[model samples]
Target: MQKEEFIAIASKVSEGLATDQQKQLFLYHLGTFAKENPEWEKLDLGFRQQIEDEIKSDIRIQVFGEAKWKPKTTRLWPRIVAIAAAVAFIILGVYFFNYRNDKHLDIDNLVMQGVGPGKNGATLTLADGKKILLSDAVKGQLANEAGVSISKTEDGQVVYKVVGVRANEAGKNNTMTTARGEQWVLELPDGTRVWLNSASSLTYPAFFAKTGSRKVELTGEAYFAVAKDKLHQFIVKTKGQDVEVLGTHFNINAYPEEESVKTTLFEGRVKVSPFYTQGEALSEGEKATVLKPGEQSVLANNTIKVLPANTEQALAWKNGYFMFENENIKSIMREVSRWYDVDVIYQGNVEQKTIEGTVSKFKNVSTVLEMLESTKVVKFKINGKQIVVMPGKDNN
Candidate 1:
C-alpha cells in the first residue's frame, strides 16, 4: 500500500470514521509493511513512532470498545519496537477475530445475553457426612475433626491443621468437591497444596499417617504441589492409575467422560502405575510409567503412553484461561461447558476442526464464544445456560 493510503486509513481510524472493512485493511497493510521491511531503521524515525502509537491505540479501542485512538507524541520509539508492535497487533487480531472477509460477520449473534464464568467455590464433606458450603462459611474454623482443626482461610482455601491430633486420630477422611462453575484450593495436613478445577473432587484424611504414604483420591482434575517428605511418599489415586511421588508438582485430568487419563508432571519425579487394590500388587500384566519434568503420561484401555507435555496448556484452568493448541472443537466446548456451567448442543454434524489460541476463562461465556466464532470455523448460539454449536460461515 502507498503511504498516502496508509495515512488516510490511520486518520479515519483515529477519528472514529473508519468502517470495519477499513479497519481491517489498515491492520492488514501494517502487518504487510512490517513483514516487507527487513531494515525498518531505514524508515523515517518520526513515522515509525507514529505507526507504533496508532497500532496500540487501535487495538485498545477494538478490544475495549473505546471511542477513538489518541496518538501519543511525547517520545520517539525505536524502529524495531514499532515493527514488533505491528506484528503483535496482527497476531492479536487473528486470535480474537478473523479480519479477512469479516465485514458482515456478526460477533454479537452468539451472545444474546451473558452467562458469567466460574469462581472459587466448593463443598467440604466431613467424614461423618456433615456438609459445609465453603462459599457461605465464614473465614475461620469450620470444624474440628479427629482433633484436627479445619478452617477456611480468608482467601477461600480449606486448610487442615493438627492441633493435638494423635497418629491414630488422623485417619478420619474429609472430602472437598467443586461443582460446575466452581473451583477451589486446599491445603492438606501434610502441607501439600491442591488446586481443584471445576466439577472435581479430592478425598483425603484429616491428617497424614505418620508412618505410611500420604494418600489422596482424586476425580476430575487437580494440580498438586506435594510437600517434600523423604520418609513418607505422597500418592494420588485416580480411576485409571496411581501416581506416587516423594515431592513434586503435577496435574492430573481423569474426568470419566474423557477418553483417557492424563498425568502431567511439572517438577520432580512421578511414578504412574496402573490402579490396584489397596493391598494388592500390580495385576499380572500391568505396567507403570515414570514421568520426568515436562513429560505427560496417558492411560487408556489399560495401556499407558508417555510423551512430551505442554505444561502451560495442561495447567491453564488453574491459571485462569483456556489455552488451546490444535485442540478439536468438541474438546474445546467440553472445557467451556465445565467452566461456564453450560450444556453444549450441536446444531449439525460439525466438522472435526481444531483451534489454536488462548482465552480468559473468567470472561462471560459470550466473550469466549465470540473468540471461537472469530475463527470462522465454528459458531455458537446461547439459550439460557445451553450453548448450541454449529459450523461457521466459512466452514459452511
Candidate 2:
C-alpha cells in the first residue's frame, strides 16, 4: 500500500475505528517497520511526534476549525476522543478475553477438586478370633505370635519384628486384620512396608522364606512399599488378583463392594492380573484394574474405571489425613464411616453433592464432619457413633 494509505490506516487504528482485520494489518506493518528501521533509537518519541503533528494539523482542523478557530457546524474533536476511548476498550477487552480463556483451559482446578486421602480406623484380629480395638491401643508391644513380636508404634503403626528366630526360618504365617473403623501399618521381614486400610487383612509368614518368592494375601485396600530383592519377587495376592513386583511402591484397592481390583503403580514395574489369568502385565505409570479374568485394564463406563495412580490421594491414610478431591458425598461418607467406625446414613438424595479438601485424621469425626458441612452442601447429626448425613436447608 502507499505510505499515505498506510498512515491513514495507522491513524484509524490509533483512533480505535479500525476493524479486527484492519488492526491485524496495522500490527503487521508496524512489526515490519520496526524491524527495518533498527537505527531509529527514539522509536516511541518519533511515533508520538508523528501522531501528535498529524492530529494537530489534519485531524484537529477536520474536527474543530482552521488555525484561526473559525466556528464550524461539525465538531470533530469530541468524535476523535470518543473513538480513541473505544479503541482502548477494545484492546483491553481482547487482552483480558485471551487471558481468561487461557486460564479456563487449565486442568489444575479440576484435579484439585477431586480425590483425597483415606481416613482413620483400622482394627486388629487376634489368632483366636478375638478382636482388639487398635485405634485406642496403648503404644507399645501388644503381643507376639510365633517368632514375630507385634508392637504398636506411637504413630499407631502395628510393626512386626522377627525375634528369637533364625533369618532362614523367618517364614511363619501370621495374619493382621483391620476392622471397619481402623487402619494399620506392617513392616515385613524383608523390610517391605504395607499400610493396611480399614476392613482389610494381610497374611504373611512371620519371617520371609529364604528360598522362594515372598508372597502375602490381602483383602480390602493397602499401600505397599516393596523392599528391593531381585532374587525373591514380592507378590500380593488379593481375592481375584495378584500383583508381583521386585521392588516398588504402589497401592492396591481390592474392596469386595467394588467390582474391580485396582493396582496403581507409582514407581518401578509390576505385573497385575486376575488370580487365574497369566502373562498380563502393567508397566510403571500404568494402572492395572482387573474386573474379571479376560477383561483388560480398562474403566468400562462409570461403574468401573481404573485411574492412574494418584499417590497423594491413594496413600493419604498412611500419611494421617483424609484428602478428598471432588469426591461424591456417598463415597466420602463410605471412607468416613470406615475410619471413624461410624454408620453413615443419608436422609435424602444428596449423593450428587461432592466435597474437595483435606483434613487431619487426628481430628475427631465430629470435627471433620463439621469442616465438610462448612462447604454448605451437607449437614451431619451425630447420634451416638452413627452419623446421619442430610442435605442442608437454606437456614441450616
Candidate 3:
C-alpha cells in the first residue's frame, strides 16, 4: 500500500469510519508498511503522529474491545522516541482477530450497581497476635511493635518506621494479609516497598538483624522494590522456592492453588533456588538459577525453569490492570475471582480458550466481564456473588 493510502485508512479506522473490509486490509498491510518504510521520518509530521496514534488505538481496542475505544490526543515526542513506542506495541503482538462491534452487554441491574473492584485494604497481625483491620484503622500510627512504629498513611499505605535500635527486637515478626477483593502496599522497616495483591500475605521481622539476610515469607502474589543494601541480601521464601537478591525489583506469584511458583525479575538480578524441607540440606552443586531483568523462573515439581517474561503482564495487578496475553480462561478467572471477591462455577461443557487484553482493575466487575465476553470465546452469568461461566454464543 502507498504511504498516503495507509495513512488514510489508519485515519478512518481511528475515527471509527472504516468498513470491516478496510480494517481487515489495513491490518494485513500493517507489517508491510512497518518493514518497508523503516524511516517513519520520511512522512509528514502530522501523518507520522496519526499513524502512531492509530497503532496505540489498535492496541487499546485489542485490549478493551471497540466498545471502549476512545480517541485520545497526545503530543508527539521526538521521532526516535515516538517511533520506538509504536514499534514496541507492534512487537508485543496486538491481535484484532476477535473485534466485535456488537458485544457490549446490557448488564443486569444487580451487576451494574454492585460487585465493584478491589481496594487498598488488609489485616495486620502483630507478633503478639493482635490483628488490626487496616481498612478500618484511621490514618497514622496504629501500633508500636518491637523497635518499629507501624502506621497507616492517609493514602492507605502501611508503613513501618524504626523507632528504636535494640538487639532484643530482632525476632519480632509481623504479618500483613489481604483478603479477596483487597490489595495493600507497605514499606518494610528496611525501606523495601511491597505491593500485596488480593488473597496474599507477607510476613517479615519487625527489625532486621545486623548479621543475617532480610527475609520474608510470601503467599499468593506481590511486587517488591527492595532497598539496595550491599551488606545484606534480601530473600523471599515461598512454598517450594526462595528468591534471593542483594537488592532488586521483582514479582512473585506463589498462590498455593497455582500449579507453579513464578518469580519474575523486573530490575537487577535474583537467584531462585529450591526450598529445602526440614532436615533437608542443599545438595552439593545444586546452584540457583540467576534470573536477569525481564526473565522469569518457574518452580514446579521441585525444579526451576527460566524463560523470557512479559514484565508488564507479571506486574499488571500492581499497576491496576488485568493484562492478559493469551492466558487460559481458568487462570484468568482465578484472578477475577480474587479481585471481585466472587466464586466461579462452570456450567455444562465450557470450551477451553485463551484470553488476551487489558482492563482497569478499578472498574466494576461488569465492565471487565463485558469486555471479556466480546472475545466470543466465553460468556458469563452473574448469580449473587457467584459467576457462572458458559461457552460463548459463537461456540454454540
Candidate 4:
C-alpha cells in the first residue's frame, strides 16, 4: 500500500475506528520495520514517533527486504502506548497491559525460598453430613444421595450425575471446599462445568431447581461455563452479589475477605446484582445489571462499577499461571499464600511495592518468589508454613 493509504488507516487505528483486519495489516507493517531496525533506541525521538515515520516509509523497500511473516493482532486499544505495549508483549511472550510504574527493583540483592505449589485436592461434604477427602478417594463411586451418583474421576474432578430424579430435597445439597493449597473442577448434574481455585468452596444442589433456575452458592474464585437451558437460568449467588445467566461463560471472585467482589464475563453475557444490604430480603422482583463479554463488574462500597476487562489475565489461573500487572506486593503475596498454603507476614511498610509479570503456578513457590525478587523491590523468607516478606537488600 502507498504512504497515504497507510497513514489514513493508521490514523483510524489511533482513533479506535479501524477494524481488527485493518489493525492486523498496520501491525504487520509496523512490527516488520521494528524487527528490522534493532537500533531504534539509539536514534529514538521517542519510540512512537520513530515507529510512525518508519511504518509510512519503505524502509524495507530501501533494500526492499523480503517479507516473511505477518503480525497477528491479539488485542488493540486507541492509544499509541497500548499499541507499543501490545507489540512488545508479542515479542516477549507475555500479555502486555499497563507497564510497571513503581520504584525499580534491585534484582541483584535478593533472597529466595523453595516451597511447593498447590495441587488438586478438595473435600466434598455430602448432604448426609459425611465428609469425603477427594484427594484420597480412589477413582470410583464416592456416594449416592437423592438418586444422584457422585464419583471421583481419574483426572481429579467431582462428577454428579442424576440417576433417577431431579429433586431439591432438603437434605440433598452438597458442598465442595478446597483448602489453602488445593483446587478442583466440578461438573454439575445439568452439565455446567466449574473450576474452583485454591481456598474456595462451591455449594450446589443435587439437581438444579425443579421449577425456576439453577442456583449455587460460592466462596472464593471460580470460572463457570454454564450449560445452556433457556428455560431455566443459571444463578451464582455469593455473599455480596448474584450473577444470573441463561447460557454464558463467566468468572467470579467473591472471597469474603476481599473488599469487593469482582465478576468478569469472558464469553456470552451475565446479569450481576450487587447487594446493598447484606441479608436483605430478596423477592422475585429483585433486578440486576447486565454485563457483556470483555466487561467486568466490581461490587464495592455497595455500588456496582463496570469497567473494561482483561479476560486473558482474569483467566490466567485456570490456564495454569498467575499473571499480574502493576499489582502491589501484599496482593501478590496473598496469592502466593493461598497457592503455597503459607501465611504471609509483612516485616514493615511494603505495600507500595508492585510488579508486572507472568509465571506458571505449576512451578515451586521459589520460582515465583525469584521472579518477584528479580524486580529488586522486595525479598522473601520461608519459615515452615509462614512466609515473611521483607524489604530488599537495597532497602536494608
TM-scores, all models, native as reference: 0.72, 0.56, 0.72, 0.72
What alpha-carbon RMSD in Å does predicted model 3 have with respect to the real structure? 11.3
Candidate 2: lDDT of 114?
19
| Alpha-carbon shift of residue 18 in model 3 (angstroms) | 18
lDDT of 3: 0.73
Q: Is candidate 2 or 4 superior in TM-score?
A: 4
Model 2 worst lDDT window (10 residues):
91-100
Candidate 1 achieves a global lDDT of 0.75
Q: Model 1, 153-224: lDDT tens per residue? A: 876788999887458434778899999899999899889999999999999998887788888999999999
> Model 2 over residues 27-63: C-alpha lDDT tens digits?
4444334334322222223233443454546554533
lDDT top scorer: 1
- Regions more than 4 Å wrong, model 2: 1-172, 276-306, 392-396
Regarding lDDT, does 1 or 2 come out ahead?
1
Cα deviation at 372, candidate 3, in Å, is 1.7
| Model 2 C-alpha lDDT versus the unseen true structure | 0.59
